[model samples]
Target: MTGTPEQVPAAEFGPPEDDIARLWTPHRMVYIGGQDKPADDTPAQCPFCRIPAGDDESGLVVARGRACYALLNLYPYNGGHLMVLPYRHVSDYPDLTDAETSELAAMTQTAMRVLRAVYAPAGFNLGMNQGEAAGAGIAAHLHQHVVPRWTGDANFLPVVGRTKALPELLADTRARLAAAWPDA
Candidate 1:
């Protein structure tokens, strides 16, 4: 005999709901839907390439070097998640010139220092997702991710619901990090 909706326990009908609370961050839908992703893999279609052409405030750029720049991630995993990349629009790490490589590394290090000063995170995750197969959202333009981590930062939201809770706005984070950036 088939059980009715009321007859079957709620947990038996579908995935069980946990006691964890939710923030209902509907704003993240845009990122999840890939709204602003480039139409093609060319430099002209890449947001990273287009961002440097505009003002720092508009681009959310924290610091700029001769060949590379550091900016806040538009869709951050954590509060102070930032990305460092060269302005040259190169895809492969081997394609970077010595100057570009140097500036990118320097900017990544400075980003960590600035985030530490501003947020006091317990630790950090710094790495580059080289290509699409390696999990790069934008494989056409290489970028290094620097995500600040604190104790209990990995809450149930991300693990259970695939949503992250950001306490601050992106513009505010950009301004704070930009101000905290160290001199060259």
Candidate 2:
């Protein structure tokens, strides 16, 4: 949406995943596009902490724990998606302690349960990016993504426009997930 300062979105956002959708909000634009490389080499502040704190309910969250926790992906690949992160905050997987590793695995099991209950997606994609070249958006903090997918869900939207078409809004998905969290 092209507009002057008064016409800007009230909420913060980021750049489009591709070209078709221009991420209009300021929040998304940062720390997204290929993981910005800093001259100072300092890691940026945690984005999940920042966004969740802003609205008090953006579906972006980190369920705290001694070792690891589950968190919703603010920019999700699919609805009812989330991630497994260790509290230790290491970017590489080898650095994870046995307890943290166990917690990550356990929380991931919970994540699958949570997504299944909430979205009932036909399938799932679970993966991790070890480093910058491998597509790790946050190269310093190693985490696993849990994306729920359906049959024929991949379409021209992302390929043609470089935009993703989500059937439901984040708020609605959050409500469903919040209601389902008790089951986890």
Candidate 3:
């Protein structure tokens, strides 16, 4: 007798399968739902501003400079994706003081080096989304993205499924990068 769709046995559908592994990322729903996103564009509610105030490990901070800091992206495009931003609640890159600008640039370079030392990615993509119109999720704070890429990293998943398959956890990746950070 035939069963309902829910009651259908997997073994009856096709040949024996063992190589495929599924990554169930239900946690991404929180990001999609915009849970921790600040209610308004203010330093008081900004996540970027609050991150540096807490402990580095808990904050997933890979490194901290005088004016800027680096932390893992809570919603990452790749395994070791990170962002470099100033501690001050400045929204525009041009508004950054000379010291903050210098430190941010230097830290971005360091983040690239540290990612190489840890993940040895094949390439990198770096940029900053300036405002809400430009696709900045948090237009209230300025932050630069540093994403590590590998050969054959792109696949049907992100294109067809709109989801990325990351092999490492953010906390573990943070620990590895922090440990490998220069002068850390």
TM-score of 1: 0.87
Listed in order, each prediction's TM-score against the native is 0.87, 0.71, 0.87
> Residue 141 error for model 1, in Å?
0.3
Best by lDDT: 3
Q: What tens-digit string does per-residue lDDT give for candidate 2 at 108-178?
A: 87778878877788989999989889987767677899889998778765666555667787777766666
Q: Candidate 3, after superposition: displacement of residue 54 in Å? A: 0.8
Between prediction 1 and prediction 3, the one with superior TM-score is: 1
Q: What does each candidate score in C-alpha RMSD?
A: 4.1, 7.8, 4.2
Model 3's alpha-carbon lDDT is 0.91
Each candidate: what lDDT?
0.90, 0.69, 0.91
Give the worst 10-residue stretch by lDDT in candidate 1: 13-22
**Model 3 poorest 10 in a row by lDDT:** 15-24
Tally clashing residue pairs in candidate 1: 0
